[model samples]
Target: MALDKKTIRLLILEDSQNEAERLVSLFRNAGRATRVHRVTSAEDLEASLGQIWDLLITAPSSAALDPTQAVSAIRRHAKDIPVIRLIEGNDSDAITEALALGAQDAVPQGEDERLVLIADRELANLEERRARRAAEVALREAEKRCQLLLDSSVDAIAYVHDGMHIYANRTYLELFGYDDVEELEGMPMIDLIASCDQVNFKEFLKNYQHQEGSAELVCGGVRADGGNFKARMHFSPAAYDGEPCIQVVIRTESDSAGLEEKLREISSQDLVTGLYNRNRFLEMLEPAVERAVNAGQEASLAYIRIDRFAGLQAELGLADADLLLSDLAQLLRARFGAQQPLARFADDVFTALLPGSPTAGAEGELRALLKQAEAHLFDIGGRTVQLTLSIGLAGLDEKTARAQDVIDRAHRCADEAGDGNALKRYDPADELAAAANRGSVVAMVRQALERNGFRLLFQPIISLRGDTYEHYEVLLRLLNPQGEEVPPTEFLAAAKEAGLAAKIDRWVLLNSIKLLAEHRTKGHNTRLFIHLSSASVQDPGLLPWLSVALKAARLPSDSLVLQLSEPDAIAYLKQAKVLAQGLEELHCKLAISQFGCALNPFSTLKHLNAGFVKVDGSYTQDLGRPENQEALKTLLASLHSQAILTIVPFVESASVLATLWQAGVNYIQGHYLQGPSQSMDYDFSPDE
Candidate 1:
């Protein structure tokens, strides 16, 4: 490396024969690279001074050497190069006088170290100045390139700092209804921001300073025209001619205009009908709820899934069905307008976000709208596609509830509406099913919990090799006020639909635990089978509850086998595996009910670790047929290979039981051995 990092050449002039020799030696020995010319006499000094040198070094006695005159003479030849003085002693006064002559610096004679030090220092200072200049040039060129790209960008671009619009590109100027970019310069970005969102935008600006990576961010924005959209902004600290500056990038909403047009083609929208697509309609509901709450507006989301859209689709085919949907969407849109955001929620379903519309208003509008929607017809593919809407409305109090909660409520209402002549409102019905449920059905379940309206009946699961049974499957039952028995099929489905499945499933497990404990205390070696739902498996709480319940019931885990329906078995496979593993730890057996019943194979069986599989009754009903018997035998062979015992369910007759046994089924369940009965109070034994 060059010890002297000077950007320009330098030369020193001195006049003393000794002092001039000293100056010459000092300049030569200087850590920096410099040229020195020494003159001994005043005439030689004057002669040398007459020549150009970056700085003049002469004997102090050269009185004719006017420091200013010497400097001015040197400048005449080298007008840009600055000069410095060399003093014979450490005379602050003399050095000050030389500096006043416009020389950049001065150093004393005999202080060779100090002179050399100043030379090195000046050289470094010169290099730094040059470097800064180079940097400035490069930045200017780069800035020009960046400006070209920013101006040409299709999206609008602008830089807003401290609320003021410091800069904007041509595109941004056009977006703001301006003819030139400078038009918006110096204008507060706050002026363009929507009044309602000004405060929010201000708060978000504070975030840019703390951000580490790029400071680029996205936010919802408003155009000068008051149109709303989203934009992504990029930012960085910069400088303009030494003035602090902020650089920015802005993109307009028009870029999405194409996608919006294409998406509208399938249009989550109906043409003849102005209804929204099922997916798009759902998307609209969330924001509607937010708007209702934030704006203190009343709103309701109605999911009017047409009752038999499939039947409608089948009758009309694509062309006419599409036309019908378009017509329906349009009709609903017309009826609701600003009051609701209307769309086709489904093939047959038309939905709307009813605003400022209370339940009573929504109910009446929906009822009247349903009549109009049903009346609307379309012709295509040579047929008229006709349909009626099933409207299920969920009242949304955006203030405290979530979008999903409102949706779930709407679906539940739709479910209860059945065949569609009626409209159901949410916010009621299953309330009583909860701890605070007040609905009639919920009240019924609550009564069962309190008045012993709950009961258990064991369905037989007999070993094929044994003349009697292996164990009895315990099923739960609830009695209504009429003393009518409600089977698991009835209430279980209802419980799940009502979102009370977990509540009922838990109750069954707890009660069964008590029964098993009581039976064990009686010296019974009965194997108790309990059925659980996929819903219960997801209750992370259920696993721990089972743990405590089993210990409290004082029943060996293996003595209690859990039977899961095929659908439930498949749906909760992972949790089922965990549950099975926990049970297996206690040597417990796992069984699947109504097995081989899924249209889709319950492939999860490979991982369930279950030990028993029961065939649905539909299979047993046809056992006399060779194909049926062969199917049964094939299933049994497969299950036997996996060590999964095969059991036949609903064995209505001895022939069915015999066929199942002959087919290699290892167990039998149903009336053939013993009908389902509350008599499960008796201990189950293989020899029963």
Candidate 2:
């Protein structure tokens, strides 16, 4: 009797096609949908091995090929595929020799049931190997991404294990007067603190680990040159290199004239405009520049000059001009907000500092704001007065090492922009040329959302254990103005920063459910896996909206499995818990994808009702290695103990399938089965 039914490809090496057909008939009778290709000569056998096949069977005493030579060829070219040798007359010595020559198992002629059973076992082994290699690739990619984020952090951050520094960002090295990470290697955490606070700091560390949350301390910091400065350090329990560590963030307090000037301006406020005075804006600019430089971020400075301020004042009089200026200031505040520093620099000039990486969208938005101001007619003292603005935008980059340099550059650009053009951007490298590139990518994203310019792609999630339900993961793609397809990785971050991620998520959710409804009408029990963003986790409206959409589509909740990345779930734990609980109430399943990379991934699951956990693909990319195999087995064992179904993704080759089966993975997915397609056309029926 057949133990399982699966579609498997087979390669046979035999002189007689009849004999190869008989061997293939055994697998077919055992309930496997077998795709068999017979190769009699050595050349044909080599060609057959080059293609995809699940198992290889060789016939001994053939006229065209030697069984030993065939095994040798398979071992050299396609070693991952299991090879079986068929001997005649129950020759024990021949079976022993074949087994020693790397054949997985040797069986006598006939006895079709035993042959089928051996093939089934070998196929399972092949599946496990393929799963493990996929995992290793995912892990390396995750590590690379983590390193990039750590390097780009704005604060001086470090990870300390056993009271010694294990890892530090670029900002941390610069703050402690170290040129390279090697200089701080094995350095004690206490050494960074001033001698005066050493005793108190030691006491704090002793009790730090036992505390529930993060702890902050204000202490004097000692630099490598022995200089001391006031510093505030925050300590939290984190993990580094697969071990527990303390994450530290240090911020040094400035004691320069700029700081004192900023303090003086904080007490006095501009009554009319509700903005900072000139000194305050310039003071904040210095710190913004420092952060942008150290963190590899860009700080944008905008210099706005009222076009022909003297003429406006003369025509409208002092009282009217003052009202107009105050009204304009109110408008600017309404538009830019007070997140960064906004200040009235002079009688008619205003300035604002934009912190973070400068995007093309910021420049385009500023210009658009300028255009709006030009188009608006102000009602001042019962009379209509029109005003225009000459705006200059300067972004912090390698050339502008000093904060004051960028400020001067913006002023020069504004001065050069005259009244005709009225807008200019300081781009020494011509990198932000408006004519060369379209307006902001964020603007493009908004337009796409408004026009419904998004498309969906589906990738099959095959069942390793012969589950009947058809599964596919839904992926999103955006079409740009040029009709070019923009991948999610390229535009998804921009959408999130622009606060449009929730809208995108809803679009995918509704569309996927609608498609699922249509797919079910075809008599196929199909399920779609959809991804959610961090913004979706916090959106209170999403769950209710999803309930309505599902009801309208007449689709069951279980047909859709909403998933979020593991890092995102950890970042927004409270919101994730709510989403998970709400999904449970809705009778929907939650999948935490890209899992097992956190400090303690299981800790995350303890708070949520995630029924499926997709193991991070990095663990399986190199499953042939013994270490990865052991790690995957351990994770699977832990997950299975909790009765949670494990999904091993990125299964690219047959080599890792056997290892995955051994590790007890319930499901598998990757490009090896199929890349994403417009239709869910994967052959789910094993009988096919």
Candidate 3:
């Protein structure tokens, strides 16, 4: 079984034993393992609460203990159990009351399917909460360990916030001639600098603040005892207690060991290229790979091999070939600079490690370098020779555990390119690899669709304009044999090629309608934003089937907001227009997501009566720039003028909220507020 699909520990607060067994069977039939504990009285409920329970199911009105008493007991115990109250019929009042009294949800009696869906949602949410708690505890422990290391260090280290001393280690305090930490705290760093070099130091600090890397300054220091000394200070960005600050380390010039430092540098450098050699490169790569795996840092590696190097070496003498290699090394150094780690790995192969580079950015840089190398003419002994490069790129992520594995993957990718000035990126699921098992994957997808092995995740779309209705964007995922959820981006293309996209879309629509209907019966006005694939948009029967599904579920047509991608709507404008008109006739709303991506986005909008337009996330991500902000504001103003509600996704932080609010964005959705989950549990009332 997958790590995510653990057995749920269920607590049932029902009077009848048979009903409890039936509920267990329902969950088991739906592919969920359950460890159930039935509670008939208050004592049983209290005892069960003592143990860890993932979900709680109770009767709305029972002879032994009602839901009210059960919920009260749960609160009294200070447990994080989700309660689902079962009502006798579609009793909206009872359901609403149960929810108001702190139940996660309420299900109608005999609706086994509805109950199981709600249970799955609750269990998933419970698991996420538990995982978050565990992560928090681990973070706290790690912080403690780091603090211990900092306190025990011998270096004179201090953390400064806004130029004032916030924290200083014992060594730092002693070096500053201060007896207690209180004396050193809240002191301006400028006060410790000698007056003669203070201006230059201030200028250095100002310049360092705008840069990406660290810098060191040699200046005169003034101690608390009115003594002076020559000191070297290294400044780097750091954070203390979750607030950004600058870390400062001061060492006296007299403590420097010049010979030792020179020897270390000589040992780490390559004689020919004057760059880091293989051993030093591996040493640097180890920590980078560790950071990428443990701290979610982004990094990439590029393996470049000179195409037809052996032929050139054979033509040129050995000395001239060495000269050519040296010339090429200079070019590499000038192109990559000191920011990235570059090394000459073998006779004709070079490696560059790009720290803090995403895969796309790394690819762009490598392609540009490849183009430059192809155009450059290397002069060796008055002989000009031009050569091409075959480069392979691989990203360092959590899946990359060993440094050697990353290099090996990149090397394999380069070899596969076959040395024609080709560039390839290492992908675990490459086309050739996937083609070998395409039949198996297609079978898995078909089986999932038939057996209801797909799961729907809901991400809340919050209203920045005070809309009170609960809104969620529906997302689909497939479960493999191991029960791990696979994102649609990984399998949807194959499904489309297999002619299953339309059928999959129908399954999502039917399930969404069924779930929404059950939820609405609990006296909540909920709306879902469902996405339509290109195949679904072009399918002539989709609109009719959707209408029938809505009517059968007895749901209001307006409650379903059908969404179409901008590209798909542009490609199939006529079909999309017809579908939009048909949905409008059914009293449903239309939304165009990833809008404003085309050369003329408004042209597509003019053809369809879309009520909502979700601007492409790139616009939101680029809001930090003034020009991008102006562009987004202009687009939002135009949409508002046309009476179209605007949604901006990928709002990652609170820093952009005021700007978005000023721009008149109707809704903002991102992980900063809440990521996609199995429940629509966002607290929209507070914003309203």
Question: Which stretches of candidate 1 lie above 4 Å from their native place?
Answer: 1-443, 450-452, 467-470, 598-602, 681-688
lDDT of each: 0.64, 0.79, 0.82
Give lDDT tens digits, candidate 2, residues 1-688: 2325657888888778777888778777767788888877889887665355778888777778887787767654424678888888676546645764668998887867788889878988877665444444345446656876777555688999878999998778867788899988899989998988999999999889788789999998887898788888999999888999999988765424244453454443566576787866765776565554343456688899999999999998888888998999887888785576788988888988877636344688788778789888899988888888998888764224456677877887788799753778775533222311454667667655544567889998888778888999999887666677776787899889878899899878867877889999999999998999999999998998788678767788899999999999999999999999999999999999999999999999999899889999898878989998999999999999999988999999989888988888889998888998989888988865
Return the clash pairs for model 3, or none.
none
Better structure of 1 and 2 per lDDT? 2
When summed lDDT is taken over every stretch of 10 residues in candidate 1, the lowest stretch is 429-438
lDDT per residue as tens, model 1, 1-688: 4545432244444434565556656666654445665533445544553333344444344544555555655543222245557677776546645654567777775666776667566656655644454454345446655766776566676766675777787667755567775668788775665667677667766776555445655666666666766667677776544555566666656754544453344445554465555666655665565554444355777877777878877776777677666665556666877745676554566667776665656798789877876676655566665667677787654232356667777777787788766788764434334322323455666656543467878776666675333377887777665667666576667667777777677777766767767766766566767887778767676666566567656567777787788887777778877877777766778888888877655476878888788777677766678998887788778778887777777777876755766778777667656877876553344453
Largest lDDT belongs to which candidate? 3
Candidate RMSDs in order: 36.8, 29.3, 29.7
Comparing 1 and 3 on TM-score, the stronger one: 3
Q: Which candidate has the top score in TM-score?
A: 2
| lDDT minimum window of 10 residues, candidate 2 | 428-437
Q: Is candidate 2 or candidate 3 better by lDDT?
A: 3
In candidate 1, position 127 carries an lDDT of: 51
Q: Model 3: how far is 430 from its true place, Å?
A: 59
